[model samples]
Target: MVDKGGSDTVFRTEERFRQALPDPASMAGWTPRSANAEIEEAPEPAANCGPDADWYCARIARGEANFEAVGEEAQFDLTAFADRSAAQDACRKEKTWSAKYTEAQVPPVPGVDSHAYYRNAGGLDGLNLFMCTGTVVAQVLLEGEGSSLDPATAHSLAQLFASRIHKAAAAQ
Candidate 1:
């Protein structure tokens, strides 16, 4: 049995501690003959074979217990990307020119017709993948468009983008 949230379900029965919680997909993966043979041999009948209130409560308790023990597996910080307003201004100016330059360099991807947009995003772990990708592309434009911002600021921005990608991948 498993919870509606797809967590392992807990059951108390005559087998009690002897029966390890069964994962549905994994159990299903086992030879059907094996599982059916075990079922036929059991002294007690199965209860709550599907997700139910009891299963949900048990799963929540288990997850909360694990969470209390280990904490979230990933973290993202965007504060390091802040306080670069001058760099941002330079980026915006460069973007204006870069758009014209890129438009001139490549016509358009076949069967694709749309203008690209540049946006600045700010936040901590609330940031998403789209924001991270845009920041990296923006960094490239800043460098190529002759921005006056120092290399250190550019490097910091790149680090922020890289860290965001790492955190997202870890979370997944």
Candidate 2:
């Protein structure tokens, strides 16, 4: 009887399942030092902004340096794509299909739900990533046919796309 947000609960559970994850304070392999009882330190001074300065940013900015500043070459610009229209047209073309298969068609394998599945496939690079939502389990399957993409590559690509989707969905 889980609600609409149950996927988040399941995701959180999976994160917690990561073996031997460290505590927040002792994150990864770093152990932060305890706070001292000495007198409070003064706040750091701000940096200068000049007319000659090309760009200014912060990492945790202090003094004359901006830690988070990106160099000119490192700056991101979407103008790299000369044929934006063609790229957009290609992306807009989504290849999708669905089928209702008989129960006998499904293998009697463990860990795979055979109750029902409505699959949808579409992605860039002709990547065969399927979203299968069934009565028992909701699964994402990435398969590749022919010499285009191997199973391992397809699986990795699927994981990358899945991660992007998960991130976008979380933001909503």
Candidate 3:
């Protein structure tokens, strides 16, 4: 979009993804971070698109959740894919570790196909999570003064998001 003189500021949020996105009400303390959910569609003639080219994105979504409380601040992201394989591919490509965090492998929640967690490498007080479900990719991040987001909690939250995705797909 930059090439076209457009920017993220100009991209309209699409409702097509709302059905499968994680609901803020599903978690306690944490509330909606963004005013509304945003759509993340794949570009036409997408680069490296899998068997299903009319894709939603590069990453998949997962189900698992965190109810025990992550911290004073938090956010969630959900990306949809055309098929499970495309989502799986995105999940597998997740970085082993990011510059600011150390990673840990976690088992996939109930219906999730894969999962990963990363804690602030500096012991600062934050955690980031990623997971993959049949046709969606979801992420959760909790941050606060001395806040902690355990894998089990993240898994629980992920499961909720994943179920929504499954339900939406079934409806279609």
Q: What are the lDDT scores of the predictions, listed in order?
A: 0.22, 0.22, 0.50
Per-residue C-alpha lDDT of model 2 across residues 1-172, encoded as one tens digit per residue: 1111112212122222121111233232323222111111332111332223222110111111001111100000010011222222212221111234211122222222112222334432222333211111122222222223334433433343234323422443
Evaluate model 1: give its TM-score.
0.19
Which candidate gets the maximum lDDT versus the true structure?
A: 3
Please say which candidate is ahead in TM-score: 1 or 2. 2
List all candidate RMSDs to the true structure: 23.2, 20.0, 9.7
lDDT of 1 by residue, 1-172 (tens): 1111111122112231112222233232222211110111222111222222221111111100000002111111111111122222323333444354222121112111212222232321111111122111112112112223233332333344344333322332
Clash count list over all predictions:
0, 1, 20
The worst-scoring run of ten residues by lDDT in candidate 2 lies at: 72-81
Show where candidate 2 strays beyond 4 Å.
1-127, 132-148
How does each model score on TM-score?
0.19, 0.23, 0.62
TM accuracy, model 3? 0.62
Scored by lDDT, model 1 comes in at: 0.22
- Among all windows of 10 consecutive residues in model 1, the one with the lowest summed lDDT is 60-69
Could you tell which candidate, 2 or 3, scores higher by TM-score?
Answer: 3
Best by TM-score: 3
Q: Could you give candidate 3's per-residue lDDT for residues 21-125 as a string of tens digits?
A: 665675556655553454434333225655443334353222222332444455566665555555555555553324345654445656555446566545556
